[model samples]
Target chain A: MSDTETLTRLSTADADGESVTLTVNGERHALRLAPWVTLLDLLRERLHLTGTKKGCDHGQCGACTVLVDGVRMNSCLQLAVMRDGCEITTVEGLAEGGRLHPVQEAFIEQDAFQCGYCTPGQICSAVGLIREGHAHTAEEIRELMSGNLCRCGAYTNIVAAIEQAMGEQAMGEQPAARGDGR
Target chain B: MNRFGYSRAGDVAGAVRERAANGAAAFIAGGTNLVDLMKENVARPERLIDVTRLPLRGIEEREGGLRLGALATNAEVAYDERVRARYPLLSSAILAGASPQLRNAATTGGNLLQRTRCYYFYDTATPCNKREPGSGCPAREGVNRIHAILGTSEHCIAVHPSDMCVAMAALDATVRVTGEGGERAIPFAEFHRLPGDTPEIDTNLGRDELVTAVDLPAESFPTHYTYLKLRDRLSYAFALVSVAVAMELDGGTIREARLALGGVAHKPWRDREAEALLRGQAPSPELFARVSDATLRDARGFGGNDFKIGLARQAIRRALSQAAAGTPQSQTDKRVQ
Candidate 1:
């Protein structure tokens, strides 16, 4: 069948024919991606930002958590093409000028992980949880961060780290100081 | 995921037109459920029409009511101050479901349209009447601890897996949609149909039509309402048997009541007659138990889910009593009062 026989007569592209622009960690990357290429794949494979881990690939597990436009999202569930012209921040971009982010420093101070496989997602999700300004207590932080599961059973420390960061960040810390971690 | 054509529609009209042009085309809003289904090979759409960029993200107030755009994210809806104050049931229900990340991406329309979490339906190797018409339902005889108890048919026993939809049914929201010919509003009660002979068709929504927005009526029953969701785990899990109750209490009597259940049937299960049982009645544990029993009078559960019948009865009574006492279940704390 000819291409006209199909419904894609508009400015449409075939699976691998689409081109999109995404700004990641203050770096702009114009990529020609297939419709099936997930944002997690684009970050890990093409852009070589391997910080975002892919766990269930489905939204069930939040291992591929990343900040999309200042909001935490499962990168594996989002197609890279759908995020055109959007800003993204990953775990690798969480440190600024060789200094760890507040969440990261708190994680270290709290010893928030055992195996450390889920650290990236936990930290990223904590950063977003703090930015969302909803979790004011340890219980609230644990509830909001329920998406990212730690198989190493580091939830207690993880919640402690988040509580410390939230307390410290709440003490007159400028909002602008956050997310510049990259 | 299979290779599929991709296009971003600038407007809702363009989206409806393009999707209508292709029979197998699908609209991706949050990609929270659809993307996961695609990865599992449960859904194989030939093309994806990206409606994320459509200019339909407004959350407007309509006199005493509220109009939520189809593109509004679940997180946005759950955290909206108006929704939290007036429609707290909806906020708590939405928070009771998926995690924060999934909520940030899921949309209002997509949440209503999410496929069932039936294990048989997701496993392509198994035969599912819902996935393929006339195909045998394995869940009916297999592990059905999470299957429906009220609206089960010989062909299917899958339940509609959405906590937000349960609250919407209790709120009496209306779904506004548009098609090639024109537009029309469907009452929330009539939008989702029972799976009688055709389990393949989940709702009354036409394949060619597109849901534009959802409108909630003025009577929110904000003062007396609670969304109690019981699941396998505390968070990031679907409901085992959830209840949403909204009642208007005058002193100790119930003037108006709207009750709905999730993880119990094809749609948010509700019995108008059962709800009528609560009207003009004094609130008591005995009265609430009678209402719960009457609500589940015809509820028959499979072997694996027979325990759900008793569980549903208790959940309904607890939810009703909570609503009557004006102490709604806290979504963040997850501790029963």
Candidate 2:
């Protein structure tokens, strides 16, 4: 099919309702939504994955961050139609088989949450930060993880959690199987 | 946000054709800026052409220069070894702008196309000449502390809000674009335009044209370079006044210099006259002060932004000193005072 024709079909397929199939948290969901529905809305409103908080509806805050194709992005800034065939991993996807991911465990041990509102986004952002392999020092962790802001001022504990997670990963305590590929 | 038609373009020609088909159709890449504007009602596109699938995400060394595809994410470009080692200014500037998740999603082309964060422009209820031409500019006499001081038209004073473009302007990059008329190259300085009578138009690119890639010259600034950004906070805030400086020194005398300023104009502010003053001059505080003066001599500030004129001057001096001393600001460094 021509690109325009395909797009036209995808957009007009549901004049009464738009249908989009999203592979979120290793599960596939076919949802009917408006064209203006943001990915954050689809996750929170329709799928009941409220674990991904919405601090700023704009892209300024990283509270709505989720892993698309294993790379972190602001779900609020993205449209549901834009992520048609992509794999999305939210905060709920971090723990597998009831065992917490290393980052999550570290956050709990480090007491990285005061209000616990920004914890999900911060944990997801730290996981993506480790995958990117950019943060080695405490300062680097603070700089790169500046997107997920904690209004409760839990930055020091957050940095410590990220560092602990990094050290565990470096020591080969957590296997590479914990994270899906980007 | 308003309801909009959506489509995905598989190729460059297909994308251009799709954009030409609709007068109000906008090509959405990262959607970091366009989505925000849509939600704010500043942009009311009737159709959106998704260009993320197009094959324009390559970063290659070509013709003794680096060719960065339009869809390459900001994180990819900033973390590329070649960019980090050769063009540290570009890497530092990109890192200094947005947060980690934003950098991961924001494309290089989208960074250039990002709109201003002007308070009046984003508020649909307010009177903004840029958002609605002939509406009259309330920011001219309102709270415009973050407004432009260099390129102020009577119509608008919104400053361009991209640290990456400031470095690109200093690096003498070129923007590659494709449209109905085929491909062409626009110099970095000419790509973004100052807000004159038409503050509505932000760039020189035609409506149907799409940015394909950005080309950087083969030359590299391995030693002397710094991107000094002063902001209200340490992170996740827009620049108050940012300076990108890359200098080539021959025994303490500047052999070549390229300078650009951000958050002070509608576009990345570049002054060849100021750059000319630093050429062949030894790295000294007095020379840096003279260059800063020449650069900001024509700056006329609004009521709240009168302090930026002096702040920008001090920033330029410190940035030059850091570059000359080979101490480019790092992530751990304290915020610029």
Candidate 3:
């Protein structure tokens, strides 16, 4: 959160390498990282923002799903250098000022996870779904959120959580809501 | 993933220039497949020219139809209002393939350039002709439940894994590209290559050429169309056998028809002779069966995927029937109907 901490986190083996400017979670970060460093690795390893889990380092699983410029994408597949000058919002940035995001609240209420490894990605994906205003039905949500896999088989409840969050966000209890009606 | 130099290009010319500078350099727009391949060591590129910054992200109205930008994300193309309205078959096919995260990151060009998802191809421990030129293909006799059943060679049997391409082949889309030699359009049918002796090459695209856009014609099979993709799972899985059918029906008789198959060949399989049989004919069970039989008459599958031949035949008939009935397969719903 401090300047020294930020610099320490942004420090890479090739610190003077590819210069990139990114705004992650409302913070402007001018970093120099290797081209091979993925955004997932940048967030987790360097920045210590481990809330974005790494289930499968490959893009097959959505555990590393994040919002880049308000669009949901697999962070593992995106190189940090490619995401230059973009606004990235990970699971750590969902809540505002000590309040849990509505999706996070809904996930807890619906008992969306057993192992809790996939909850962050599921929650972030749900937030993105609400943002996209594409999936209006439970079936659509299930289809759209198919990327985020929960190995504990908590899909039924995860969908329920997304459904609840979708309704809540529609009603505009959350500030990030687009007011897309349910 | 292996270390690779990354450079962001501003325009198509610059992207092509960067790629032409180095033969091993690959243009990366929405690195969904390329990054995955890099992780698996399947594609060890020394440098990646990021073309996402290029001004090819627009989905514009071109000549009454549409010009889908090469950089446009799969989600952007599938969810575009015009695409959903005019070309629902393309929308359905795109939605039927990848998940939301993947679709969000995968570009139109990247989708076409994506490598095969064969088991032996992905498993680097095994010998795959597609991966390694002279290593030999284990899928010819090994675990090959997902191998190709049509247009296969003794060297390789890996299928072109793209739901969108199947619909593109049916819709007659044209791939527009640019290189140092200038620009030229590749016909949809001829864009991909069948694995004859060189199993390494997937498409006819030159290493230096950069795809700028894909232009769709004004003609659309609006009323009668269906993209029926039958996969191993309900969602997020690659197709076992998929069919895209677009028809122009005049009351009861078929005026024109375009049919394409996926997960059955090295490219999206389209049989003009089989489609020719439907001209000026009424939609009937026998006619559908005849056409299906004609398409799969020469289809010979490897051991594990022999059942796919029968599945492909039934799937073709069902998709054609669905197009005739004006009931398209829903990507949201997992039901085959």
In TM-score terms, which candidate is top?
3
Model 1 C-alpha lDDT per residue in residues B313-332, reported as the tens digit of each score: 99999999999999999988
DockQ of each: 0.51, 0.48, 0.54
Quote the lDDT for B295 in model 1.
97
Better of 1 and 3 by lDDT: 3
Model 3 global lDDT (CA atoms, 0 to 1): 0.90
TM-score of predicted structure 3: 0.96
lDDT tens digits, residues B65-176, model 2?
8999999999999999999988999999999998888888899999999999999999999988889999989888999899899978999999999999999999999999
**Which segments of candidate 2 are over 4 A away from where they belong?**
A1-19, A174-182, B335-337
Put down candidate 1 lDDT per residue, A1-182, tens digits, no spaces. Answer: 12242124212343446889999998998877778778887787677888888787787778899999999999989998999999999988888999889889888877889988789999999999999999987788889999999998889889888877887787765332222111
**Which digits, one per residue and each the tens of the lDDT, describe model 3 over residues B1-337?**
5667778888888888889989999989888998988888888999999998888889999998899999999999999999999999999999999899999999999999999999888888999888999999999988889989999999999999999999999999999999999999999999999999999999999889999999999988887999999888889999999999999999899999999999999999999999999999999999999999999989997889999999999999999999999999988887877
Each model's chain A TM-score: 0.85, 0.85, 0.87
Best by lDDT: 3
As for candidate 2, its clashing pairs are none
Query: Which candidate, 1 or 2, has the higher DockQ?
Result: 1
Question: For candidate 1, what is the interface RMSD?
Answer: 4.1
Q: What is the full ranking by TM-score, best candidate first?
A: 3, 1, 2
